[model samples]
Target: MRFKLQTDYALRALVYMAAKQGENCTTDEIAGYFQISAAHLGRVIRRLQNHGYVKAIRGRRGGVRLDRDPESVNLGEVVEVLEEGAQPLDPPTGEPGNGVDDALRLKAVLRRAHGLFVNYLNKVTLAELVAEGLPEPQPAQQPSEESAPAEPQPTVAAEPEVASSPEKTPEPVGAPSAAPGYGRPGSPTYGGY
Candidate 1:
């Protein structure tokens, strides 16, 4: 359910590049703006270059720029490229056919859900995200005290205090132990004889 910080940085870096279309962007510039590590941004830029999302130029005035138009770049595709082998959920693993079928079933359901999420994302392009003419933020209005709902107070339960007296520790494995009353050898309540 959580994206890696690298993914977030990749998106930011791409956005910055897209916004500065026609202008070459340096790793130091992107890193400085985003407050990220320059070395890390360099790695990200290199990966993007390898993936054809960006083109790097060399020279005193050279830097990196987007290879494609912002409108043509799909956010979902970019995310996929950046997170090549990432899975939102871990694969299910447990003893087979021993009441573990439910866990496997849940895993399948979650996988399907994640697929649907990605499918929705695929429909959105980066152009939509970086579009100009965004709606302005509305000013917040102070609510009258009489009209405002009272904040709910959280209830905290007191925890039972443990005595400081030292208790007897259980016998270690392979050590001998006395049997308890009314229990057969190897019973669940007592250690095995």
Candidate 2:
């Protein structure tokens, strides 16, 4: 359920690039802005480049840019490209006849749920996330003295206690006084003492 730091960095770098639009941004610039290591950023950029998410240029004015429009890129696709062997859950492993078969069935169900989640993500693009503009919160309205009073809260019902069987009763502490052979016929204390 957790993403690696590299994936997180890659997403941040992509967002920065998307924000810049047509401008070319250098790894050093991104590292400086995010306070990350330049060497780490360089590696992240290379991975993005290999995944066709970014295009790198070489020269004095050269840097990295998004290969495609932000609207055309899905967040899930970006995650897949940036993450290696990244999955929502681990695959099940076990022998056929063992109880592992049941575990594998449960894993399959979980995998299906994960697939649905990924499908939802695939439907949303980065542009959608960026398109949401910030709005100011509205102030709360004051209640008038003439307004009706709120209704009282309802009381919760108590649960009934269940009685236990005689066999389940616990013995009294320090109440027993019996020797190993006290009840035996041949013992020193045969019946009563």
Candidate 3:
């Protein structure tokens, strides 16, 4: 269920462009804003351009501008395109029919959950993401780990709470893993993740 950082960068870049309207956003600009790599963001920008989300301008004023309206771009569709790098699930294997039925059931559940996720995203547009304006405070030019001077550590806070939407209800917790002779420390057949 994890998404790569490239997806995060792509969405951020799009939001920046969507907010800018006519301004062309450069990879360097986005990279500096998000404290990410410009080269990596450039590759993401290329993929986005190929998918018709943006058009890249070359030369002195080289940058990317939104090709389609923000409202016209569905988040789900964009996520599908960006998730091309996700590894496909390997088919059920080993132990002839030992867990084929269970595996198939699990696969079906995974597929259904994934479909619901994407379908939910489909209802939202890029416009909604930028409606509240860009996030702040604008980050300073980030110093590299080695060159940056160390500062006093701040007290860590508890995990932030998230507001749940009325449109969705939480699923019940599932049973714990039933791997035989596993989970317990120093178990004979324990396999660490």
**Top of the candidates by TM-score:** 3
Residues 52-138 of candidate 1: C-alpha lDDT, one tens digit per residue: 888998999999988888888886787778778577567657788874788778878888887886777588655655554211222
lDDT of each: 0.66, 0.65, 0.70
Instruction: Please provide TM-scores, in order, for all candidate models, with all chains considered together.
Output: 0.64, 0.60, 0.66
- lDDT of predicted model 3: 0.70
**Local accuracy of candidate 3 as per-residue lDDT tens digits, 1-96:** 545666766777887889889688788887797677888889989999999999988888778888999999987888889987353355687675
Error of 2 at 19 (Å): 0.5
Q: If the candidates were sorted by their TM-score against the true structure, best first, what order would they fall in?
A: 3, 1, 2
Each candidate's root-mean-square deviation in Å? 23.1, 27.7, 14.8
Give candidate 3's root-mean-square deviation (CA, Å): 14.8
Model with the higher TM-score, candidate 1 or 3: 3
Q: Compared to the true structure, candidate 2 yields what TM-score? A: 0.60
- Misplaced by over 4 Å in model 3 are 85-88, 95-97, 136-193
Per-residue error (Å), model 3, residue 11: 1.2
Writing each residue's lDDT as its tens digit, candidate 2 over 1-193 gives 4456676577667767777786899998887776667787799889889888899988999999888788998867876665654665566567786877887778788778867766775886656544531111121112341256657666554444455754534333333333333223344322221
